[model samples]
Target chain A: MSFSRRIIIPLGFVLLIGYYGQAQSSYQTGLLPALNVNTKLNRGWSINFKFESRQQLQRGIFGEEHDQDYEYVLSDLALVAGKKIGFDQSLAGGYLMRFRGQDMIHRLIQQFTIVRRYSSFRLAHRIAADQTMSAGASMTLRLRYRLSTEWPLKGQSVDPREFYIKANHEYLNVLQGEDYDLEIRFVPLLGYKFTDSNKTELGVDYRLDSFLQDHPRQRFWLRLIWYRVF
Target chain B: MKYIFPLFILVLGTFQPLSAQLKFEREYRLKSREVPPAALEFMQALPFTKKIRWYREEGYQRTSIEAKTKHQSKRYSIEFDTSGQIEDVEVIIKWKNISAETRQLISKQLGQNHQRFRVRKVQIQYTGTPQALREFIAGTSDESRVTIRYELIVKAKTDGQFQRFEYLFSEAGEFIKRALIIDQNSDHLEF
Candidate 1:
């Protein structure tokens, strides 16, 4: 097939799927903007900070006449210290202070990550454990695992001014006092490498929260992140 | 039966068989700082070369530095390692420039190794130059003394699968070695 045909075919199928698969689920759209900074303290240690904002969108991206109604859902600041373990592994611990409307929560987080490379694709696996605390709410413990893959769209490897694609899937298990819940999230992002030390990503974060004896709640999130290294 | 055919198409589309692949090449320019100092020094020492530029390339375990320059009527590319040791010097040449005897010999070898083969790109390479490298860097040697080699990038079928391979041969068309051309994947450093 010709180059134009190759692209037109898959795109045509996607449009067909969109036209036919119109079943709507119980989900809310959220927009998140975040800035992440990593400052290297030494050869082995680095500190990372992220400021994040979550806004609950009242309408979809295509709903133009709705006047862009949205509400500030939550915000958080996270700080983490990472230590390089080996060529392709790292260990990190962090803290998060979050405010959802009027309620505040604190979290302690620890994680380990390993990355492997395979012919134009990078695969990364991260495991994390955290504890969350609030004034009147019971303490919560959560364990999560995420697997991600990244590939350069236009070159053998991503470099400055190049575009890449990253996709990840995460599973989270939470225990609050005696109640247990599970959440699964999938994110597909397109990223641009502005320079060696800067990158930007735009993606959709789809999350499904399942609780015992309750119908699962779905969250569709538009996520944008800016990453910088110093 | 209705579900089986749709499922088959989905599976076939999602999981591509390990057969022939589409090959592509795209070069990214690197900053001067990214180029190793040793590779830069070696390039500076070459005589009669002008309009030199440097780049760091992917698709290799060790860092590879590529320097392109115009020497008289011909354009030359010299690939070096991080330590400034020369890997190969290549000059792009037309397919007809290759002697018919050598081309026929290469064709026979490819026929024996693969079910089918097609040549895609060709370069005349110079190697076996440890002594020549030292003398050249010291500004005491000429280019024509080194042994010439033919380096080819070709698509070939093997084990019922087709993939690109880089083939190395002597000027006499004796096969030395061949390596499957695979991409280099690296994680952008987080910090």
Candidate 2:
């Protein structure tokens, strides 16, 4: 009875299946394909949970045409708690889960992002953290800024069709070269506004890249983007 | 021969614009140091990051990484000679963050949508070479449609997350309205 055949066979099969699914998921994909679940649990409170299997491959079979090629896949989970200070300013913080392959990365990063909104502009800043993967770890002391903008086209269409733009800038002072580098993007976004409390974002964005000194070679080239929010 | 080469260099260098814009279309394997003293000097001044092995697809060269910077972001491409002398310093591109108006519009759109619409799919493509985008949009004297386009999905209040917005940008990276793509919704809203 202690070693019941029923329990043994099914348990062993389940374990085998779990192991196989995980095994095949590796090397078979570019990055860890995961899911992102975002919910507004309550007013001024939200949850951003993500789970990704992290595995970064630099210079794989895809690197022949180019010199360097890599991909990063990761899963994370986070709970955000915040309150609206002003009519449009929101302050929030949360926890996240870092995953590598089938293993869970233990580094926890506590982040504070300021979601400040004006009647016409909404600016979000990381306030404290540089390209960090570890908890409370910041790369450089300089501040990193990310700015996003949108404009509604009037008389053009009765629809909620508006324009969208986003910008991310990183200030780095490495090896004593104080520098500021920026990457800006703009998308003539089309939004659908509802009479009540419904809105949707649909548009294509053109990404143009520019690099200042204190910077390096990157995709700061022109790119195309397709985005949807409904 | 040496004297002639130097003379030619001086003549062309003098006529070059005070500031030139660089494009990635020229070469896949970018190595100004690919030649001589320029490489030697850049290597010497190579900041700590300069040693941070970067390739065409990886490192800072990743197209997406560059695209993520602000619209007003600026990139510089410098070439040095074997003797460690500066050969050329050109502004690859300069961009500023999207206008404040544009950002507000996106925030409003992302904030109000109540449903999770399925992405039929997504893609962005360059109309042609940077020169082509410049020539097509610039060669014309009018401010009409440009070669560069912004194509995206548009949703309808009718509840179907279906719609498309296509905008064109000129070679100078300015918005062009005549090139816009707009259509009507099936269950149009009658307000």
Q: Pick the candidate with the highest lDDT.
A: 1
A83-188 per-residue lDDT for model 2 (tens digits): 3332233454555556645654343334445443332333455443323343343332323333333332332123333333333332332221353444333323
What is the C-alpha local distance difference test score of candidate 1?
0.72
Per-model clash counts, in order, read 0, 57
Instruction: Give the runs in model 2 whose Cα sits over 4 Å from its true position.
Output: A1-37, A41-43, A50-65, A68-72, A106-121, A124-126, A130-143, A153-163, A170-230, B1-191
What does candidate 1's lDDT look like per residue over A34-110, in tens digits? 89888866555778898999998864323234334578888999999987665456889999999997899999999
Q: What is the C-alpha lDDT of each candidate?
A: 0.72, 0.33
Question: Against the true two-chain complex, what DockQ does each candidate achieve?
Answer: 0.05, 0.01
Clashes of 1: 0
Q: Among these predicted structures, which one has the highest DockQ?
A: 1
Native-to-model Cα distance after best TM-score fit, residue A48 in candidate 1, in Å: 0.3
What does candidate 1 score in Cα RMSD to the true structure?
Answer: 19.0
Q: Score every model by TM-score.
A: 0.53, 0.30
Error of 2 at A227 (Å): 10
